[model samples]
Target chain A: MKYISEYRDRQVIDRLAGQIASFRDTKAVFMEVCGTHTMSIHRFDIPSLLPAGLRLLSGPGCPVCVTPVGYMDHAIALARQGKHIIATFGDLVRVPGSTSTLEKARAEGADVRTVYSITEALELARTHPGRKVIFLAIGFETTAPATAAGVLQAQKEQLRNFCILSAHKVMPPALEMLASEGVKIDGYLCPGHVSVITGEEIYRFIPRKYGVGCVIAGFEPADILLAILLLLKQVTDGKPRVENAYKRAVRKEGNPKAREMMESVFRPVDTEWRGLGMVKKSGLVLREEFASMDAAGQIRVMVEPPVEPQGCICGQILKGIAAPSDCPLFGKMCHPGNPVGACMVSSEGTCQNAFKFQSDG
Target chain B: MDELIMMAHGSGGKKMHELIRNLFVKYFRNPFLESGGDAAVVPPEPGHIAFTTDSYVVDPLFFPGGDIGKLAVSGTINDLAVSGAAPRYISAGFIIEEGFPVKDLESVVRSMAGTAKQAGVQIVAGDTKVVNKGKCDRLFVNTSGVGIISEKHTHIATADHVKAGDQVIISGYVGDHGMAVLSQREGFPVKTGLKSDCTPLNDLIGKVLERFDHVHFMRDPTRGGVATALCELAEGRQFGVLIKEPAIPVREEVMGLSEMFGFDPLYVPCEGRVLIVADQSVSQGILHTLHGHPDGENAAVIGEITTGNWGKVVLETIAGGRRIIHMLTGEQLPRIC
Candidate 1:
């Protein structure tokens, strides 16, 4: 609790809140590009504490929310075959596919288990040698290294029953795509955990090309508030540069060993996002050496074209263009219990966060 | 007997009789059970009858601070207690696996008897059944209790009685019971020295009801913790709830585990805590009285009911911000009770 309790000190938070209130003059729109940040901002109700001139928007950072419906459909299809055990993180279990969700498939007796890390999936394969284990690998850079390490370990151990359906995505291309689309984002609070792996250097393009201020932030209340204050300072000084507010964890040069492991196992590929369409080279695929451990290449399953839920504005919400309340089916049709969209399915999804924290608004 | 429970232990023969007379009856020796009759025939008391039943299928059969037996009895007692009833008699039924250890069963039964004695309740009648090894877990307990709701406390502790100005008071720290079970199941590497806050709260609740008539609603925040309980209270009601984040009591260790796992302590389960809703004027008095009891020593006034944002519960965060608190949708696995 040493690192956690100190950051949540009410006295420090109040002082920072006062500083943010006084520092802001002109209206500004800032976007937090991590699902964890979105969750923390809503969980702590940071938006209501900020001055009215500042607006915080949630970007496409939730890996579970942005995972395309086709990925879930394929995973569910494989699970329905009863020939494979589908393992995933807890965040992706309830997200709906084209027709059914992994949770529904699980109720129908599919062998779906929620593993904390991909290494657990490998352990499942090791324990149950007869059953085929397919990990639904979905996450950003912070999680990709672990998945890569699992694959490398599987290869070293020669685990034939273990494979992964890689839906791993990178952050830089998506940020570039957001800027190219002129989405009206004035500043950005970059993801802290992702920066720990990719490093602060990956976000240099945001300021050099798009002229938008970027500040890498941690998940704590003080960290986020400090990131906001830094972005405000950059904007007020007419300086567009990337700053690291989460210096305790993140560095300009990220963990080289993790990057090297991930690079050896995965290669960049074009993949589709749930809300945002395909961005070139934004996804990770198994390298040729580890292609045998790829579930997508091994499994021969035909999935139907995904049909978006009627009137769900999750796509717009993920891009920070529309709020969760903007959708007509928000509370009535799309709720966390029976989510109609990916945004309402994942706990870190923008709509889910809004539904949980900003429903009264 | 056999050292372990066999199929013959549930065959209604000499083995079954010995298992009951020696193992169960030896521990549960109340006069009502000593009657040896098929049913517990009790005379009617001058009050409304409150009947509640619960089945405990908790994994591990035992946990840090309590076991399945303790949970079964305390769970039933808490249900009746929160309904303004004075729990008196409970009937226990057991569904046990065929090869379960006799020693473990005795420990569980002894725990049930001990909890009943502490809560001043009687275990009157009971039944036992055995299934094949794979058909059931080691043991499962089902308990149904009958309590008397005196005229003074009748209908007072209902959610419908919650008005706009009612204050929400939690008995003590939240999330201890949940974190204790999770740490055991998930094998969290960090040692927090946390134990399950599972205990009988009927005495504490009865004391509060006896002294305060302004109490409107009472609920045990068992499975879904305080957030779910408050949301349930707001549902279908014409009022909203606003809770202060800093006001809610959570232990530092519990908070640490919660943060490490990216979980909100507000939604963590608590087996031993009771959430009370009372008029604003009597809130401090109720808090003072609760502090006198061991179970309610850490009690705090955490929130209040409001007319705005009807059917919703919002949290005023420690950062001087506000957000809505919603009910949990998915299964928070490794369930404690």
Candidate 2:
């Protein structure tokens, strides 16, 4: 807890909050594009510390929140086929599909298991050779390299029963799409863990092209307050640049080995996002050489066309255009226990975070 | 006797009688159990009686600090202790899997006897049975406890008695039992040097009930940790609870593992911790008293009840932020997504 506990020092956080409070002059909207950042911001109640003019928006950062309904439907369909053992991260198990969730599928006797990492899924395949182990690979750059490594490890060990259903996404393309769509933004708080893998250089485009300040931030109260101060200073000075506020962990060049492994195993492909619909080259797919390890290509299962739940504005919520309370079904027909949208399902979802922390007016 | 438990041991024949007399009675020797009757007959106390039962089916029958036997005994005792009752007697039932090593059974029975003695309670009555190998885990224990609650303490420590301005005091650290079990079961690579906090709290609670007149609510943060206990105390109530994140004590090792696993320590389980709500006037006195005991050395006043955010639990974070702490819905599984 050395590095973690120090960043949570109350004295440092108060000083940084004061700095941020002093610099506020005009209405500015900043977005944090990582699920962990969004969760940490809400977990620490950072909004209450900010001045009145600055507004922080949660962007399409949660991989589970942004994953389209069809992909989950397909995964659920494969799980229901009774031939595959579906291994997935815990958050995805609760995310609702068009008709069913992985939790419901599991309760209905599907062979679904939750694993902490993709390597555990590969290990499951090694032990349970009689059944096919299909890993529901999902996340942004922070987790993609691990999945890629899992695939390479599986191939090296020649594990025939191991495969992955890739729903991996990249952050830069989604940010570009957010900027191109004229979403109001003055700066960006880039994801710390993702930047650690892809390097801070990947986020320089936002500062250069859109003239928006981008600060890669760590997931601590002081770290976030410092990042906000940096962004506000850039706005006040009429200058925009890529700044690193999480220098303790993230590096300028990122982890070269992880990037190399990710690039070697997967390729960028145009994929659909839940709210931002069909962002070009925003997702990663398994390479053709590793096609046999792709669960989508290896399994032949028919799934119905994905259908959105009626009156669920998760799309708008993920895009940061709508608040969770703005939805008609929020806290009425939809809740964490019986969620109708992805935003109400995962713990990192904006709606879930808002519902848990925000006061009801 | 066979080296391991067999089907004949459950047949209520000569083998069953000898096993009971040799193993059960040998360790759990007491005047009440010596009667060798189907029921324990004791004089009624001059107060209300508290009765509770629990079953333990924990995997890896043995854990870092305690096993299923100790867990079953301490768990039942803690339930009664937190209710402002002094536990007196307990009945144990054991279901042994066939082919289980007799040595392990003896060890479990010894652990149960040791825990019950430490709690100042007697295993007055008992039953034993054997099942097929796969029908049950290696061993399972079911315990029912009986305690005596005085007239004054009968209704003083219920959640309904809680009101605004009451202070919430948590005894010791949280998440030790949960992380210990998870690490042992999953073989986590992280070396946490952590052990389960699974001791009986009857003595600790007894000292407080004897000296305190302002106790409002008392609960052990067992399965869902402090967060769930606070939520239960606030649910459908007229008051809300606000806690300080920095005020809650969590071991550095547990904190490190929680961070690595994407888990919140508040939602993890703790077997030997209690959350006590008392009047704010005596909160400091209660903290001082709790800190004097070994089990409550790390105790602190974590939060207070308020009229705002009724029926909810909010945490004032270390950095001057606030968020609602909800009851855990499902398992606190790791998040890689």
RMSD of each: 2.1, 2.6
Clashing pairs in 2: none
Error of 1 at A72 (Å): 0.9
With candidate 1 superimposed using the best TM-score fit, by how many Å does residue A123's alpha carbon deviate from the native? 1.8
TM-score of each: 0.95, 0.95
Identify the runs in model 1 with alpha carbons over 4 angstroms from their true place: A359-361, B11-14, B159-165, B186-191, B210-213, B307-310
lDDT, residue A342, candidate 1: 87
lDDT for residue B158 in candidate 2, whole number 0-100? 66
Q: Over the stretch A225-328, how does candidate 2's per-residue lDDT look in tens digits?
A: 98999999899888999999999999899999999999999999999999999999989999999999999999999998999999999898878898788999
lDDT of 1 by residue, B2-37 (tens): 778898888989999998899788988878788899
